[model samples]
Target: MTRTYRTLDVPVRGGDLRVGVWEDGTPGAPTVVAVHGVTASHLAWQLVAEALPGVRIVAPDLRGRGRSNELSGPAGMAAHADDLAAVFAHLDIPAGLVVGHSMGAFVSLAFAHRHPGLLARLLLVDGGLPLATPPGLSGDELVAAILGPTAERLSMRFPDVAAYLALWRAHPAFAADWTPELEEYLAYDLVPDGGGSLRPATSYRTTLEDTVDLNTGTAVTDALAALGHPTRFLTVPRGLQNEAPGLYSPEHAARLVATYPAVRHERWDDLNHYTVVMSEPGARGVAAVIREELSALG
Candidate 1:
């Protein structure tokens, strides 16, 4: 899966933001803009991008993460969607499919609401629908459960990039699935702090704000109901049970499908939240589903 990388500086409300475009496949091919989750960069879609050879993939490191750190403003879904709109304008992308994961899903949904004419369809991977905070679960507890080792790794300051990579290498999630692509992806998230130590690009405050805003699920529900374009909801079995049981469950998804009127819902039984777009087999399956939906659109 060889790729050509180019840095794009998109002008937004506050300042210019950098987006890394991994151009693959043919020119003028239908584009798929890949949006990653909170605390994740463009690398989150490495495997998925590799599998989709027929599509021209445009993945951006969202504001406050990856190459877009200099472009800071508000860190909400609406702002993120606006950043994406700027990316489309800079690239001259008329209209194509939009694929979003986790927080990226929220951004895509918001983008759909704000700029419906910019996207032909949307593929929301484990996001886009309303998420509920579990009963008896504190906000801190929910963050710990959903973010897991990634949060811990982000909190620690590594003495060097090598040390940071070592900690990432030992993660349980990547132990069996580690690849060169994953290594490169991890490298993009680390930055040198003043003390000759590396840290995650995302600030703790940014993460905290996103985690505490789960109660605003009505906004996402309203966005979904307002969306007139073709939409697909891809669910991961594990996160559906662990993070927000009521909201992510199959029954809830079915109800959402009924409510949305235009949404197409499906469940991928084997993959977890991260693996659904990060691993080869999982990405291939997801890409296949997207290809099917895109084909149906034409």
Candidate 2:
């Protein structure tokens, strides 16, 4: 069965935050809130939604990205977490599971910390844990080292959505994973730049702020130190460009799991960071994990 997809503007701090809702049309079905990675929109979870026909997925265009790009104020993990609280309040979601990918995973950590009662369990995909970065690096250096081309693309201007799609189609990570769904996800990232060209909807400054907050700010560190919820983390063997070791090196992933002994951890050897939730195979794996968690909840 084809699940239904829709979007709505949920009122938040600066402006309305655009949220995507994917549902199976089964009344009272289990709902799961999904959070996209940095520089990505709610559409990143579309594949996962399709894979789980029995589930309802709620994802938001975080402030400073996607339709929420117009939202005012500085971006931080705490601010994003609070905005998530607003999302739950507006939707009247008392509590349920949350799946966060990349920066979304970091936001989920802060969200679980700030609004503990709102998250029953957390499924962190390739994020939420402290990244092992070199010391003595400036904020710009940190963003560059960690994000590389992902951050660079935010400053680029394209003549149209096609140009943007072309850029993504050329990405090494999507070389063998390209699909119409991936095309739609990339196309949604473009917005008019006011100069007749189109640019990615993610704001560079917002990305920087968020990058710094997640990597350097004490909120995530503190959250990690005080984690009390049932959490599961999934790491990919490859990264944004399909490079090996991905976000967390095997040793790093193992160390994190050891550090947070209570948090369940797994490494998906075949998928890259982006594909873990964006591609069909990756979505099937994630949907399976979500189903396991939901069944456990019951």
Q: Best lDDT goes to which candidate?
A: 2
Candidate 2 lDDT over residue span 1-298, tens digit each: 5678999999988888999999878877898999999999999999999988878899999999999999988789999999999999998885879999999999999999999999788999999998989988888899998899999999999998888888888899988899999989888999999999999999889989999999889989898888988999999999888999889999999999889998999988889999999899999999999999888778
How much lDDT does each candidate structure score?
0.76, 0.92
Q: Model 2's lDDT to the true fold? A: 0.92
Worst 10 residues of 1 by lDDT: 238-247
The RMSD (Cα, Å) of candidate 1 is 2.9
What lDDT does candidate 1 reach at residue 10? 79
RMSD of each: 2.9, 0.9
Which pairs in model 2 have colliding backbones? none
**Per-residue lDDT of candidate 1, residues 73-177 (tens digit):** 667777788889999998898687899998888889889888889988888898877765566666667677666655666678877778878876666555567
Give the Cα error of residue 35 in candidate 1, in Å: 0.6
What's model 1's lDDT at 73? 66
